[model samples]
Target: MSDEVKVSDAEALRFHAEGRPGKLAIAPTKPLDTARDLSLAYSPGVAAPCLEIFRDPNLVFDYTSRGNLVAIVSNGTAVLGLGNLGALGAKPVMEGK
Candidate 1:
């Protein structure tokens, strides 16, 4: 890659500061355009599955995104051979992953 194509420190900082600070966002998997959809996605219609999951804990994977989602957690004490860098310093690295 050429030097001009590489991201500079100022560009990296500006990219994060432009709109939302973080790189992650949540989006609904089901339609939520109507009141019925809202009810199904949120309240009364959601209760059936909630009750099922309550009855069987394993149903949580079927009813929720838990099966597909992954969470990466770290204290930032050790990162990619950089040594103990701490949490704030690790934010960019974690987001990249």
Candidate 2:
């Protein structure tokens, strides 16, 4: 792994501000555009998998996003600015990630 240093507050802030919201996005890897796709994704066809999941709850991991998502939480009590704390204080750090 390479060592990358955070140079200046302004540079850091610029990157954060440019992406104001966050650093990652989630999108479906498969396409669902036709009637068959609709059926397979949401209706009768979907129910087949849903029933399988219902029979074995652990199957949710194989069919849904729950298996791959991550939640990063913090209280922000010790951020760079003593004046900032809580969710608002941690927003920049979270977005930078």
Compare the candidates by lDDT and give the number of the best one.
1
lDDT of each: 0.88, 0.75
- Tell me the lDDT of model 2 at 57: 98
Q: Which ten residues in a row have the lowest lDDT in candidate 1?
A: 1-10
- Candidate 1 local distance difference test against the native: 0.88
Please provide, for model 1 over 46-90, each residue's C-alpha lDDT reduced to its tens digit, 9 standing for 90 to 100. Answer: 899999999999999999998887878988999989988999889
The C-alpha local distance difference test score for the whole of candidate 2 amounts to 0.75
Residue 12 in candidate 2 has what lDDT? Answer: 63
lDDT over C-alpha atoms for residue 83 of model 1:
86
Given candidate 1, what's the lDDT at residue 94? 90
Candidate 2 lDDT by residue in tens digits, 1-97:
7698758989766765685445666777668878898788888888887899999999999888777877767677766666557887776676555
Model 1 misplaced stretches (Cα beyond 4 Å): 1-23
TM-score of 2: 0.65
| Deviation in Å, model 1, residue 89 alpha carbon | 1.7
